[model samples]
Target: MTNYKINMGRGFKATTLLLVMSACILLSGCAGKAQTGTQGNAPAPGKGSAATNQNNTGGQPEQQKKAVSETEGLPSGVKVQKVLKDISLKNNYHKKVELLTDGGKRITITDPNGGLVLLNLEYEGTILEVSGRKVTVQLDHGGQQTMTIPDNMTIEDDDNLGLNKGVEIEWTVDADGNIQNVELDD
Candidate 1:
């Protein structure tokens, strides 16, 4: 094996030059990608890394369906992979789905239709209050959100499938955070 050494003894001028060069290279690459993807160039992402591989695969759904199946406890026939939770909606209830890639860095999906891959997420929360089919959960983002409970459900402790305060609930949800299926965690 060969030994490599980074010169930590470099002066401020060298460091500054290195930083400027890096900035230029990154900016140039970003400009190229932005030009290809956008009309006016407001700095949106170009082709996504995760979906481009599966979505553009000769117009096939088998590989996409297979990938969506890996997500645990998703609803049948629901092709979304993750659903973001929020206290309110943007663009009139239009929500965003995020996927973890590139060493756990999250990339916001630029594609509206990600083929069979989607953002059907499962949220884990503590039940703050419950009444009928309505439930309020203390979300992972440090706020409470109210959602409607699905009819066909299984509750771990409550055989009646009725939600109660202080219980932990894991729910399969859509991009809007609406509960599609739910079960008790404890």
Candidate 2:
């Protein structure tokens, strides 16, 4: 009977020790302390010092704005103060037709019809050719080209002002300085 009691005591002690050790470990993990390998969340190497300065000053960081393309001039009566990206098109009911981008901003333009149009603007816009439903534009980079108005798609000008939903168009100067072949939608 003595031996049995001794064994029970040993088991109880072991269980108690385990529970205490577990609690200590959990409590240690919750303690707050600066971690190694980083200095108070400082900016890493290669990032400009401007970011850190802005954070330290508690002021908003200055954003670098993109310049407007010379080729993509504003229309005669319509002034385009800023070029936007990520334009969207949807039906009158607000159903999403597509997402447009000037390569960055998401623009959404609703059409009178139940169709949505999304425009993705490039850095520099150049009208190369509008063959059938395919409209190709010259990219800013030399020899590179971007095409809009995918094949097997029907495009109708809602405003009849040259810009059509789901169609890509660009203005070009001709010998007579007149806008020609402006509509390219496939």
Candidate 3:
């Protein structure tokens, strides 16, 4: 008659959960820092203005900062020249960068991706397979790339590899995705 017993489901221990939460909180402050360029000299606190007269402890009035024009080094009253546009990079697939030139004039720059430009690229991977002038390479970061070799694309197989070989390839491709040069590193 005393065979009846109680059964309860298992639950997480509070001590273990607390440790994980504490670790996450402590590690959250280890994020990368931002990159800031050179900073200008800041005026001391309590200074009214650059032209305000303030006596130092040595009894000398503070010097006022001189105002210089943007074209200080150039001829007087001459307009300063600046870039009108940038095409080294692209903000989007079809977006062209706009820049301000001299006299506050705006100019537009065409993206290099939209036109033909010579680009040299290098990749180190294992040659998984090779078919005629086409080669498939397996990258070190778990990926593969198939390269098409054109008649004008130079190929220098220093490694003398056929298949399944660690190879480094240097190639140049045009903006139209056409291979123009290929060099295999030893």
Candidate 4:
């Protein structure tokens, strides 16, 4: 009986040691694969070129600029002429309103219920549009309002304006110089 007990103890120790060694080997293999950087050898989704891969890895790429909305781009060269508030149009009426850009060229606004709004420079304040993160404003006269600008919108030091930050417009302007009534384009 004593010999049998000793054998059992030896067998248990051998099994435990084998399990421990197997676990260590498995963990080491995983670490090696990670170090090699060849887990799948396939590029991750949305990670194509080196630049895109850097962006995917939460690393900013060289020569790549951060994207800014169109309204933010407007207030730089342009200046705000006036701020139209309590604008009682037929449809929407905004609370805190601001007209931005040099000739009131661009409109940056925040409404009570509505979200962020942006007007264009070329078009007079007649054309108003709403874009929370993005927007498309159609002028009451003619043309389309786009919230996409390639470069970063910058504001230089020039006091030909009243409002400092951005403003929120309550109403949307149509292409015909009328308040925006129709639903936004998808």
Question: How many clashing pairs does model 4 include?
Answer: 23
Per-residue CA lDDT of model 1 for 8-44, tens digit only, reads 2335346647867885675466556655764753322
Q: Who wins the TM-score comparison? A: 1
Give the TM-score ranking, best first.
1, 3, 2, 4
4 Cα displacement, candidate 3 (Å): 83
Candidate 1 stretches greater than 4 Å from native? 1-116, 154-162, 175-178
Please write out the lDDT profile of model 4 over residues 1-186, one tens digit for every residue.
011011223444576588679856754674465458764663443244476555456422211112224344453344344555434221121233445433333433322223443332334322143333243544443444454322232211122221112322123342233332212111
TM-score of each: 0.36, 0.22, 0.31, 0.20
Top lDDT model: 1
> Over all chains combined, what TM-score does candidate 3 have?
0.31
Between candidates 2 and 3, the one scoring higher on TM-score is 3
Query: Global CA lDDT of candidate 1, please?
Result: 0.45
Stretch of 10 with least lDDT, candidate 3: 58-67
Score residue 2 of candidate 3 by CA lDDT. Answer: 19
Question: Per-residue CA lDDT of candidate 2, range 9-38, in tens?
Answer: 344457658866884564344322222435
lDDT of each: 0.45, 0.33, 0.37, 0.35
Q: After superposition, how far is residue 89 of candidate 2 from its true place, in Å?
A: 25
The alpha-carbon lDDT assigned to residue 82 of candidate 4 equals 58
RMSD of each: 19.0, 27.8, 24.3, 29.3
**Superposed Cα deviation of residue 53, candidate 2 (Å):** 9.0
